[model samples]
Target: MSCVKLLNDFPFTFSREATYQVCEKVETRCSFLDKLGIHLAGIWICECSCGSSDLPLDHLRSDKGWSLPNRLCPCRGPLSILKKQLCSWSEYYEWRGISLDSPVALLLHWPLTMYQAIQLAFGKQLTNETTDELCIHYLGPERELYQTAVFGELHALLPGVRVHIDFVGPEVPHDRDGETISLSSYAHCMEANCSCKTPISTDDSSKITLRFHSGYYHDCYEELTKEFLPDLIIAPNAGIAAYKSWLPTIELIREIEVPTIFSDYCEEACHLAANCITSVTGTPLAIPVQLNPFRHPLAVEDSALLLPCYSNCFLFGI
Candidate 1:
């Protein structure tokens, strides 16, 4: 089937009331595929961004605002990384109408295999031995966690999937004896400066190729879409929220015509992406249902399916 047609046929209808039901359906379908020893492969986009409040006072005051170059705090820490640390997953759930004791809440602690199963059910999964490739774009300090999640989840679902991770931010920092040290001593991963293909193997024989590049939106778009074409995009609101404006990245996705699975942490970034996609595809998109005392949730007008997780966070495809 054509890629666009496949995306349009994804098995879930967007509805706040039926989000959990859709997740259950995905799980059931993926379970059936696993029993057949079938493996599916596709490229997925994973990205992170910081909250605007995390920006430093000076950086926020600059003519370019949060878009200023070398945007870091006085302590030499990336604001995006700091904001990630501050995000309260528990609070997010509380806002979603899910209590800690609820059975659905247990899904949060489910293994990455379950998550991958859900993802595989959304897009076309390959049955061949050819390694499935997943492309991840991350910024700030939480990248390691994001990488671990991606790897773990894929490993759970498809043990042979290959992962390509692109770290699009400043050098990771290390703290030793109260001194902060930048890992600049390590080789850079820019498409221009480094070899595009470098392989690292996991314990289970899954291979991962790692790359690092500047987090500037234009640079990231050039490398991800033009240099490394992916089948699916898994964009995180936090990563995209780092910028005051993410039109270029949104436009890049529209131009590439790749199926994207967006994770919404903040309502504003989610709305921006939904609106951009709506304009491109001429499909009306709306924010998800609002969770009281939190914020209006992001919802797409004609999504194939919508699954709300952790209350405020949502997963949907277009």
Candidate 2:
């Protein structure tokens, strides 16, 4: 299937109610899933700004946000990674209504994974205290450009702190190269009476600001860091081993030592990237390969391999 078809079939902007209505009737009796019908795996449900606060893992897993068979033969393999998440869904979701199966949580995974990587590398220095503003340099953003508004979840996930993300990559649209978007409020539901629609008083507001730079990170590094340096750098599903362009970027990251982290679609990719980084920069990973708790809950289409693959399933640091 074409990538555009996948994007259209699974609109990430749908409201939570609308998403549930679409997936509620899907039967879970089948033991195997066909590629054509796997679009449900990509379903996204943007829960109202606040789905009534957080709930326990047991409750979250028990509820249904999307459909899946009782025993899908393919899921028993790599897809089982979802059941072995590194952190509880509560770490990523502050709401009770969204299920662990929902891909609505996927877009927010970028920020949540950044939060986890920060905690892993810097301990509590950045996140424990609310006084310090955190700046992040995010690399290689494509589809995420369309999902920018969903990133407002970062404000709720990291309360009382200011976050500035500079999205630097060649895929960034030329027209928006230097445009900056400031998010002052959470993404709200379609319902007019949603309580989250209540405007925040000036005294209680915090902003998550994002800027776009259209080019390779290394090519734009000098200008991007001229004013302020990032506390951390993140690249999601970065095919480091596949691209020779990553060599110079890897060297640059080593020189700066800014606690950069990357995630891949699978363990093999993470391992390959780890080796590439070690060979180029003569430096080993600061954070070893491990599963990402906030990874997307759907399987990606891959005909060349027998093992299942999902976006951002594994993470490592350099």
Candidate 3:
């Protein structure tokens, strides 16, 4: 099917409700997600101004902020890290909502496999097979304990809420590429910079429904479209109360009315897919966010070594 005809996944109509009759927090908003017993979890990764706060794994007693050159903390200081995450969606949303006049937008830079700041509420089985011993730092006792504690606390707070994680679009038969694809841990997976779709040698001819779990808007979704128009863009629900930085990338899809797949998986997958694909439009989903390691601007020798994992899934917002 032609890509244009195959990409339509993001809209549904709902009967309007009396806003004035609903509660303050409920009535002021205009979203139809409540019908599906779903809540819009806006994951805002904002450039903090005063920095909500961060206490690295090493230093937990004293609260700290992420350093600069990383995520711009509107908290006025960099609190995240090259590999470490600095904040949380819950904290970010609470603070940013009060700060912005109209709805605010943000840009999100996520490490496809290795999550730094943006993480799924319910932790997943994290895997790292790097040569360096420190690579296991993410899976250490302390980190695992942290994940357990985070989930424990969340489970207590959000009674029946589900948890999910997101990967660079679902693993297609095609190799994945991304923009600024970081090869820190799995550098050996590819050569310095080569262009050979290695691992993701999938049935490219077969169309797949690429999915994602996001708390962004259509404007940001369009950013990916402008860079590389994918088949369809999908998200669980919008009009959320979380996310200090709802990426403008997803928002772009809505603005352009790019057909999108809406899922209720914000509470399920890391990719924020939906519970059920109600709109069976035979739409194909593709996020033009892939990177070609073999084709990167690197030394020839290095490029030769990093060819195995050369995928198109390493791009901007995959």
Instruction: Go through the candidates in order and give each one's C-alpha lDDT.
Output: 0.34, 0.59, 0.22
TM-scores for the candidates: 0.40, 0.70, 0.20
Top candidate by lDDT: 2
Writing each residue's lDDT as its tens digit, candidate 1 over 183-241 gives 21111122332321222234424544445454543445665555566655544433344
Off by over 4 Å in 2: 1-86, 90-103, 125-131, 202-205
lDDT, candidate 2, 1-318, per-residue tens = 133222223323332222232223232212112322333232222121122123222221111222333221111112111222236455333242344443345456665677677766675534325354778999997656655655665565555567888999987767778788776655444344544455433233345788889999899999898766998899988999999988888888888889888998767788999999999878778889987766654445322543445567778897
Per-model tally of clashing residue pairs: 15, 0, 97
User: How do these models rank on TM-score, best leading?
Assistant: 2, 1, 3
Residue range 97-202, candidate 3, lDDT tens digits: 2222112111111122223211231133222212101110010011111111112111111212222212222211122222221111110111223321122122
**Candidate 3 Cα deviation (angstroms), residue 264:** 3.4
